[model samples]
Target: MHQPTVQDFQSLKRILRYVKGTKHHGLPIIPGDSQLCTYTDADWASDTSDRKSITGHFTFMGPNLISWFIKEQVTVAKSSTEAEYRALSAATSETIWLRHLSAKLRLEQNIPTTIYCDNISAIAIAKNPVFHGRTKHIEID
Candidate 1:
């Protein structure tokens, strides 16, 4: 692992302090409302660095937050469609893990969970089992 720089240590301390100061910021998840669902979104080409973007996702058990994550895309996207697809895929992988964990804990999701995205093209690509000629480049699993 890389050694932590002074700035890195300061950032970590600041984050810890923020967490300590805002203990009630996070919502409590209740198990019974298994209407669990997840949503993920991203701003494509939002960052200058490597032209990478930011992804934000959240999982909910009814109205309560069960899990959330925000991350940067590793690859630069040639188009917004690709960027959105990548972000949704990343969030999907995480939600799948969360689903399994919830099942193990006896709080298994009872209904089909829908992952909502504002991008219609992304949604179409995801839902369509067959890849058309235009989406042949997309390697969504």
Candidate 2:
């Protein structure tokens, strides 16, 4: 900001205008079922620049969308299943946090949280007790 250029000033002006335009907009939280559920997926090596996978997921408190995340994977995944498993892991973490928070807020989730993942191989890997050599490289917790 020491030597701000015209582009910087224009960008600032545009941001301020957007804020002013959406000042009255707000997210509505309606009362309904309190079950926690999440859906997650990832695209393996989708980024041509760095060849990193993109992880995306969204969580819902009953029928309402409560949380979402979309980001590039820190490490390159060798296979599609690995990439999808990574996304599932991230979503599971988010679900755990939300479950804890809900419990504290008196919205005790009696039912277990369900995480929906599209990749059958990733789901199988997660459920299997025995780990195979192919998934040895993945850091599982």
Candidate 3:
């Protein structure tokens, strides 16, 4: 921002506090199945300025985290369904990349990796591509 405000400083302080609290936190890779697991979510219209949702996803290889991300949706979502669908799409793309990376490493993952989502409507949209009435607003590309 061109000019920082008190609110911005407060937010910065909060972030620093969180970082301090988690200073010793670490990701642990334990012995487990070689299955890939992914979890995704979206907070519908969470951004006060843009009314856009924040999408987040975390992916795991066996018991270790391999990939994760949090992004603000560029387009404002019309509903929770749309927001969740966007999140799902992002998570799916990341899963594809992880699958390719695993193959390159000769750790060929088993087919049909699991992607978990809390939104039922997003799952439905992903399963039935022909039902475009609810997702017509989303660009095909």
Candidate 4:
């Protein structure tokens, strides 16, 4: 059921190479940790071709890697404001799913699942949600 094309084959080859490179990576879980925490990390603006950076993230519950995303954004952002907004949106989307997944697994989720981001503006925007000329276009809700 594999797609057949030169680009497809090349992409598969690249994926295989990456897997081969990180074959020994392991998730280290401590002995008796009960907290089911979700981690939303990012690697902004990784794409050199377009100013639209990629956001890389991974969610961990105790020691288990629950969810991850490594996709490039579609739009070209002018400032960190726009990039951080996109990153926040992406992290929030993953956090919602992580919360639902924690519930489904019968884990005791502490209220207010924290979405961690290094960007000060992103954190401010998430907290305030104030309607302003600059923030009116942010699609994160």
Estimate the lDDT of model 2. 0.90
lDDT of each: 0.79, 0.90, 0.88, 0.68
The global Cα lDDT (0 to 1) of model 1 is 0.79
Candidate 3 RMSD to the correct structure: 10.0
Model 2 CA deviation exceeding 4 Å by range: 1-24
Residue 4 in candidate 4, Cα distance off native in Å? 31
For candidate 1, report its TM-score: 0.74
**Pick by lDDT: 1 or 4, better one:** 1
Error of 2 at 136 (Å): 0.4
Best by TM-score: 2
lDDT of 1 by residue, 4-85 (tens): 7999999999999998898887755455567668888888989986788788888887878878888887777777877778
Q: Over the stretch 1-141, how does candidate 2's per-residue lDDT look in tens digits?
A: 469999999999999999789877756667989999999999999999999999999999988899999999999999998999999999999999999899878999999999999999899888983754578877563
Q: Least lDDT summed over 10 consecutive residues: which range in candidate 2?
A: 132-141
Q: How close is each model in CA RMSD to the real structure?
A: 7.3, 8.2, 10.0, 7.8
| Candidate number of the best lDDT | 2
Q: Please count the clashing residue pairs in each candidate, in the order shown.
A: 0, 0, 0, 1
TM-score of each: 0.74, 0.79, 0.78, 0.67
| Model 1 CA deviation exceeding 4 Å by range | 1-25, 28-32
Ten-residue segment with the worst summed lDDT in candidate 4? 33-42
**Count of backbone collisions in candidate 1:** 0
Determine which window of 10 residues in candidate 1 has minimal summed lDDT.
Answer: 132-141
